[model samples]
Every structure is written in C-alpha cells, then in structure tokens.
Target: MKLYIVRHGQTEWNVEKRMQGWGDSPLTQTGIRDAGLLRERIKEVPFDEAWASPLKRAEQTADILVPDQQIHVHEGLKEMRLGSMEGKRQEDLHPSEKKTWQTFWEDPERFQPNGGETYGEVEKRVNGFLEDISRTSSGNVLLVTHTVVIKLLINRFEDRPLRRIWEPPYVHETCLTIVDWDGTNGKIEVSCSIDHTKAGRGW
Candidate 1:
C-alpha cells in the first residue's frame, strides 16, 4: 500500500506560535493557498481511500486535497492533547515548565505535561489506526493529520527511537510525505516536500 501523508495547513494559532493540541484555530489565507497548491501537486495520485483527523483544520485540508473522495474521520489521528498548555504560547510557560516542555519534545516517552497524553499513548492509538488501514485498504491512501502525529508516523516507519522525536526532517505545513508499505514493512519515498509552495510567479 502507498500512503500520502499531509500535515494540516497553517492556522491562526500557528502564526501566533501557540500550543494547539486538541484545541483548534481556523486556517490562514496562506494556509488555504498552500492547500490549493498541494492539491495541484498530488492531483494525479488516484487515491482509493482517505482519512483525516476529526479536527476541522485537518478535515478542511483533506477536503481541499481530495475533493470528491469521502474522508473518514479517525479520532486516532487527532493531535496530542496538551491539557493545561493548550492555547498558551511557549513564552507563557513558567521557567520550570518550559524546561520540562522542551524535554518532553526531546524525550517524549519520559516526560509529559500534567494532563497531556504521553508519547506512548499517542503511539499506541496511531499504530492501531495504521494497522487497521493496512488491513482494510489495498490501494493508495491519503491521511491529513497534525504535525506531531505525522512525526510519530515517520518515526515508526523509519525505526527511530522515541527520544529523537524532535530530531531533523521536520514536517512542514501542507507538505507531502509518501510511504510505501507492504504489510510488515514500510519505506519512505518522500520525507517532506514544499516544492508546491515555491515563491515564483506561478507556483
């Protein structure tokens, strides 16, 4: 099976640099334009199935990317719940909390916010969702999800440890990452591509 994974477009919270886990903000104009550009880039893929997080931002992006297809909303694809940190800017965190937050990203399996879901929890749900998709779908699949979820998915496919969650190969907004999975194994074809969002006259 071939998978096309896309991180949702930019939101008001994204521009403001706020924590948006479980919370939501509408897409910016640039976000819509990027989604449109992404649509054009992947229009010829002929996806047989599509799935997206229940969040509106991801749902909206999926709709734009796969106009006529029915996108199944999966709770497992939702962003990590940030608990008390939701809607707060990184600068707003207390000095101690900020240090822990930074550590949480670097070593998610060991640290987490007071009320947030742990990395292991998110991994379990996402892995279950992937297993179901692999079992039920036979052709190309498109998934529109959050940044952290995309990161976790890539980490799993690449056999990287959870401690390196914040490592290189970032997942950019509306960027495409392709993976080819054959039941027990998967290969990354494209990591993250922003070629559709070039600054030329006609991108």
Candidate 2:
C-alpha cells in the first residue's frame, strides 16, 4: 500500500515558536493556502482511505486536502505530549528548563523532560498506527499529522536509532512524504517535499 503522509500546516503556536505537542491551535491563513496548494499538486492521486490525528490543526489540513473523503481520526497519530512544555515559547523557557529543552533536540536519547514524553513513547504509538493500518487497508492512504509523528514514521521506515531521529530535511508545513508499505516493510518514495509551498518557489 502507498501512504501519502503530510505534516499539518503552520499554526499560531508555530509562528510563536511554542511547544505545540498535544496542545491545540488554529491554522494560520498561510497554512490553509498551502494545504490548498498541495491539494492541487496531488489532486489526482487515488486515495483509498484517509487518516489524521484528532488535533484540529491536522483535521483541518485533512479536510482541505481530501474534501470528499472521510477522515478517520486516530488517537495513535496524535503529536507527542510535551506535558509541561505544551504551549511554552522556546525563548521563554526557564534557565534549567531551557537546558532540558536543548537536550530534546541535541541528544534526544538522553532527553528527560520535566513532564514531557520521551521519543520511545511516541514510537510505540506510531508503530501501532502503522501496523493497524497495514493490516486493514490497501491501495493509497492519506495521513495528516504533526512534525514529531511524521519524523517518527520516517525513523520506523528507515530503522534509524533514536539519536539520529532529528536528521536533515526538516518536515515543513504541509510538506508531502510518500512511502510504499508492503505489509512488513515501508520504503520511502519521497522525503519531505515542499514543492507546492510559496517559500519553495525560490522567493
């Protein structure tokens, strides 16, 4: 089965550089427009099923991308819950909290958040979601989720270690990633591609 995975568009928290895990926010106008741009880019792909995180940002993107399809919300696809950091801006984190936040990006394997989750926890849910879908679905499938979830999905597909999860090619807003899953394994057909975005046009 072919999976078309897309990161949800930019949100108010995104603009503020806040930790958006589990917390909710409305999509910016740019977010909606870019999703529409992507909808045009992949308008012809025949998607057999559609899934998205229950978060409003992801749900909105799914609706824009596949207006005619039924988007099944999956709890397993939700963003990593960054407990205490949930809505806190990057620059505003306290001194000691800042160190842990830096660890989250630099040495993810050693990151022990005050209340946030470890990468391993998010991986478990991602694995469950993939297994459930692979066992029950076929043909093309569309999934809309957050950056961390999408990155974890890539880590699963490539079998990368936790330390290397934050590799290059960041998942931009509404970026499209295509993968081919043959029940047991998944091969990436495309990484994070933002060809449909305004910034991608060399502006």
Candidate 3:
C-alpha cells in the first residue's frame, strides 16, 4: 500500500519553536495557505481513505486537503504530551531541558520531564495505529500531524534511533513523505521515498 505521511503546515507554536505537545494550536495564516496549496497538488492523486490526528492543526490541514470526506480520527496519532513544556519555547526552557532532550535520545523508555510523556509511551500508541493501518491490502493513506509524531512514525517503519530520525528539521509547510510498505504483514522494509521540500514547482 502507498502511505503518504505529511507534516501539517506552520502553526504559531511552530514559528515560535515551541513544543506544541498535543496542544490544540490553530494553524497560522501561512499554514492555511499551505494546506490549500497541498489540496490542489494532491487532488490529482486518487486518495482512497483519510486519517488524521484529532488536533486542530492537523485536522484543519486534512479538512482543507480533503474536504467532504469523513476523517477517521485516530487517537494514537497525537503528538507526545509535553505536560509542563507545552507552549514553551525551547530557548526559554531550563538548562536541564537540553539535557532532557538529549536523554530522550539515549533512552526513550524512562526519560520524562515534569509532566512530559516519555518517547516510549508515545511509541506504544503510535505503533498501535500503524499496525491497524498496515493490515489493509491497498489504498492511499494520509496522516497530517506534528513534527515529532512524523519523525516517530518514520522511525517505526525504518529502523533508526529516535534522535537520528529527528536529526533534521528541514520540513517546511505541506511537506510530503512517500512511504512504501509491503502487505507481507509483519515488518516493513522501506525501499525508497522522497522529500518534496526541494521540488521547485511552487508546491
């Protein structure tokens, strides 16, 4: 099956480099425009089913991209809960914040901030959603979500360390990740994919 993993456009939190942490932040004006452009670009492809995170940013993007279609709101697709760090800029975080972020990479299983959910906690839920979707034989599926969740999902399909998967932050508004997962049913072996950020077609 063809999986289209897309990151939602810029939100106010995104521009501020704040950790949205499952918070419901409205999309920025730029975000709305980006979602609309994505609509026109993706309308050409025959999307069979739509899946989205329940967050407003992701839902808004999904709605603009695939209106009139009933969205399967998957709770497992949510961004990791930041607890105390929600809406706070990384720059404003305590010195321990950097250490915490680094610790998350070293060991996701037990790392946690004041009230932040560990990466391991997020993984379990995200994996459940992915397993459910992979059961399907064939269809075009789209997941509009936050940056951290996007990286986490990619890591699930491709065996890589969480920190490595999150090493890059070049994803712009309306970026698309084309992932190919076989229906063999157990684990996915990724063959090829593209980052449309560099595509110079005014997308």
Per-prediction TM-score: 0.95, 0.95, 0.82
Query: Which candidate number maximizes lDDT?
Result: 2
lDDT of 3 by residue, 42-127 (tens): 77777777888898888888998899787777988888887777878877877877678656657665569778788878888888
lDDT ranking from best to worst?
A: 2, 1, 3
Worst 10 residues of 2 by lDDT: 194-203
lDDT of 2 by residue, 1-203 (tens): 99999999899999988989999899999899999989998999999999999999999999999999999999889998887888999888889888988888999888777777788888888888988997799999999998889998888889888888899769999999999989778899999999889654555
Q: Residue 95: error of model 3 in Å?
A: 4.1
Give the residue spans of candidate 2 off by over 4 A. 198-203
Q: Give the C-alpha miss distance for residue 13 in model 2, angstroms.
A: 0.8
Each model's lDDT comes to: 0.88, 0.90, 0.72
Task: Give the Å error, residue 38, model 2.
Answer: 0.4
Order of candidates by TM-score, top first? 2, 1, 3
Kindly report which residue stretches of model 3 are placed more than 4 angstroms away from their true locations once superposed: 102-110, 183-203
Give the lowest summed-lDDT range of ten residues in model 3. Answer: 185-194
Question: lDDT tens string, model 1, 1-203?
Answer: 99899999999999999999899999999888899999998988999999999999999999999999999999889998888888999989878769768877666777777688888888889988988887799789999999889889888888999988788788889988999998667899998888898842265
What residue pairs clash in candidate 2, if any at all?
none
